[model samples]
Each structure stands twice: as structure tokens, then as C-alpha cells.
Target: MTDSTHTIHPVWLRATHWLNALAVVTMTMSGWRIYNASPLFDFKFTKAITLGGWLGGAIQWHFAAMWLLAANGLVYLLCNVGTGRIVRKFFPLSPRAIVADLRAAFRGRLSHADLRQYNAVQRATYLFVIADAVLLVLSGLVLWKSVQFPLLRELLGGYEAARLVHFFAMATMVAFVAVHLAMAALVPRTLLAMIRGR
Candidate 1:
């Protein structure tokens, strides 16, 4: 067996991963505040878990975080593509593989013996998250400037529809974060590998 202490996450991966985590947390909190300002649903996130004291303040925070997320995400993607990590680590995914891995995971039979390789479930989740983030950014742009982003606005079914899309995208990201944290806890060494790059 290879030494688990060997580099698993490269420096760039570690940096971008943590930066993305920060941006996601910041955006989610501020977004909750924004949602409370004009909720589409009956429920609202309490102030204790949300950032920004008011609507305007929340908008500012959310926009700021959005830029951070966008920039960091771009860098991460470029590095992944440049290094061929995107194809090596996340490709060859199939529906059957995902289903098999997911069942194994639920049955506590899945392996984390290889930190450098992603199981099919991980590949699908990460890919979905990447797509979801892109959707969030586009929908957010539509909501922030409907007239300025007429093409995106129309594609998303207009301003009001864009708002729903953004909200749901945010919700999906939050759920992913929750599961990610839980999985990290369940496999503490994986967290260490991320932090220590091994």
C-alpha cells in the first residue's frame, strides 16, 4: 500500500478548496438574509444563522461573496483542466457505477482506502455541484440586472423565474455542504488529507 501521508491534494487544490468553502459559507448566510427580505416560501432562516442586518447590507455581502466564488472557481477549474486532473479524477462516470457506489456507501461497504481516486458517487456529486454553481451565478446575474442580462433572463424564463432558480440553487449548494461536512466527519482522515495535502 502507498503511504497515506503522500500528497493527495495538491497545493492548488487545497487552496481553492478552502477558498470555495469560505465563499460558499459567506454567500449562504448573506443569501439567507436576502431571502428573508422577500421570501418565495413561507419559511425563513433565522437571523442568528444569517449575515447582514438588512436587505441592502445582505445584497452587498452576497455580491462580494459571489465575486470571490466566481474567481476562485475559475482558477480551480483552469488548474484542474490544465493538470488533466478533471479527466483523470472525475471521468468515466456511469449511472450504473453511481448506483452501485451509492448503495455500497449506504450499506457501509464503500471504501475510502484510496483518497486520490473518487468513487462514482463522488464524481457525480462534484459534477452536479459544478453545474449547480454555474446555474447559481447565471440566475443571480439575471436577478441582479434583468435588463442588463436580457439573454440570460430570457433563457431562465424572465426575472421572477430567475429568482426561484437562484433560491433553489442556493438550497442545493447548502444541502451539498451539509452532506460534505458529515462525510468529512465520518472519515476524518479525508479532512486531514485535504488540509495537509496528503
Candidate 2:
């Protein structure tokens, strides 16, 4: 396809992407603050960088951002699926191709010329993150409403297990965000494309 034929990210995708980013960041920060209250791990986040003021405030922020994240994610999923962009741009990933791409990436030979097409690693990462997001939402629900969602809570192995799963999912998403930001730093145009849809 010619340069003019290349399609940028649709407005819906771009808008939802940024909105989800904001929601996730807010939720993650506030989540850390809340986790500190319960002493889940040895390390704790300082209040300076965290969203919300205290445990109660953090819970409020987390709940508010949860709604935004869920709604934005649903819209993103629907748009991508309805437009066939999910399959067209990210499907048919092969293990062999992913291995080859990893090899190329490690050797500093991976190409990024086709902004419209996701490379094997990109496709795999995106898929993994989507699954991770779904897991986060389910686990979050179980943690939030363990008694109300008995089946979901039990499926996740009860309240304690659900909290663990939720923490792990949040960590995975944080790692993904780090790598995503690094990739964007290396290829600034990708970030710009998401912002300006060029």
C-alpha cells in the first residue's frame, strides 16, 4: 500500500487508548496505596507519588477509575472487533514467527516500517495484555464483592486468592506499561501516531 493508503489509528481507538491509560495509571497508584494498608508485600509505595490521600480515599479513587477503565476497555474491544481490526492487525500469530522476531529484535535488526501491521512480538504482547486486563477486572470484582459474586470469588479461589491474583495481574500490567513506554521512547512516532492519528 502507498503512504496515502495507510490507515492511522481511528479516533475511537486513540481516545480510548489514552483514557484507559489514564484510568489504569490512577488505579495502579491508588492500588499501591491501598495495598500498603494491608501489608501484602515487604515493599511499600510512598504516599507522595500515589493517588488519593489515605486508605478510604484510595478506595474511592480505585473504584472511580475502575469504572472508567472497564467502560473504556469495553468500547475499545467492541470497536476493534466490529471493525475487524483485531483480527486483521493482530491475529494469526505463529510461534515460529515470534521466535524469529525475537531473534531479530535481540540482534537489533527488527524493522518498524509498517506502522499499520503489528510484528509477532507486538501481537503477542498486545494479546497477553488484553488477557491480563480481563483477568484484572474479574479478580478486582471478586476482591471488591466477594460475598456478592460468590461464584466469581470461588472461581478465583476465594477472597485471599483473589487478592493475590489481582496483585499479580496489576504487577504484570505495570511491567507491560514499562516495556510499552520504552518501546515508544525508541520509536517516538508510534506515540505520536496514537496521539495525533497520523
Candidate 3:
């Protein structure tokens, strides 16, 4: 198919993508609020940008967003894998190619003409984010239901360890969001394609 006539992102892809984005953003903000109630580290996120009014409210929002994120992510994963899009679009990431792309990106020579196809670096980043999301969900499950999921909790090294893993995964996700926004700023057309599925 020609580029002009081709549809880059299908409706399901676009819908789930945005829904997942919304879920993650809300979950992250509310999670910050909840974290501030009893921090694990030295620092705490300010209340100004946090979601929900208080700790209980934040927990409610977090759980709501968690369900949304989990459901949307499951659909996205199943659809992508069933249609072979996962293999065709994201697999076979070569370390050499990723390194080359990273160099080009650093040198400000990367191209973003083909929104349908991802570069090596982009593919690697997406895969990493997906893995991180899975880790977050699993660790969260352990944190939420340690008593019911004793095996899972044990596998993740108990409640406290699971919480630590969850925190780091959240931090990684936030970093990914920052980089994703930067990339969107650099290539505005990519954002338009996502919005309109061009």
C-alpha cells in the first residue's frame, strides 16, 4: 500500500493507546498523592499536581485507574499479538541497530517520516516500557493482595520488596513519559497520526 492511502494505526490500536495513556497518567498522579501519605524515600511529590483530594481518595482513583490500565493493556497485548503486529512491528530488535539509532538520535539526525514503522531505538524503548508495565502490574498485585496471593508475593520478595519494585517501575514509566513527550514535541506529525490514525 502507498503511504498516502495506508492507515498507520487501526482504530483499536489508537483507542487502547489513548486509554492506556489516560489510565497511566491518572494512576501516576494519584499514586504520587498516596505515596506522599507515607513516603518510602526522602522526597515527596508536592500536592499541587497530585490527583484526588486526600489519601483515601487517591487510593480510590489509583485502584480505578489500575483496572482501566490492566484491562486496556490486556486488550492491546492480545490484539497486537493475535494480528502479528507485535512480531512484525516490534521484534527482532538488533543491538547494533539500536546503538546506531541511538547515535543518530543523539546527533539530531533521526528521521520520523514513517510513523507506522518504528526505528530500532523506538522499538527497544516500546518493548522496555511494555515489560516495565507488566512488572508494575505484577508488583502491584502483590502489594494489593499479599495475603491472597502468597505465592506471588513471595515470588516478588514479600510486600515491602514488591512496593520498592513498584516504586522504581513507576519512576521508570514517568521517565518514559518525559521522553515520549519530548519526541512528540520534536515530531508533531507523529502526535497527529496517533490522534487521527493517519
- Please give the range of 10 consecutive residues that has the lowest summed lDDT in model 1: 1-10
Q: Rate the local accuracy (lDDT) of all candidates.
A: 0.93, 0.92, 0.93
TM-score of each: 0.96, 0.96, 0.96
Which pairs of residues clash in candidate 1, taking residues 3 or more apart in a chain or in different chains?
A: none
lDDT of 1: 0.93
lDDT of 3 at 194: 89
Compared with the true structure, the alpha-carbon lDDT of candidate 3 equals: 0.93
* Runs with alpha carbons beyond 4 Å of true place in candidate 3: 1-5
Residue-level lDDT of model 2, residues 1-198, one tens digit each, is 325465478789889999999999999999999998987888888889888889999999999999999999999999999999999988899999999999999998999887878899999999999999999999999988899999999999999999999999999999999999999999998998898777
RMSD of 2: 2.0
The pairs that clash in candidate 2 are none
Model 1, span 58-177: residue lDDT tens:
889999999999999999999999999999999999999999999999999999998998999999999999999999989988988999988899999999999999999998998999
Report lDDT (Cα) of residue 70, candidate 3. 98
Q: Indicate the residue-level lDDT of 78 in model 3.
A: 100
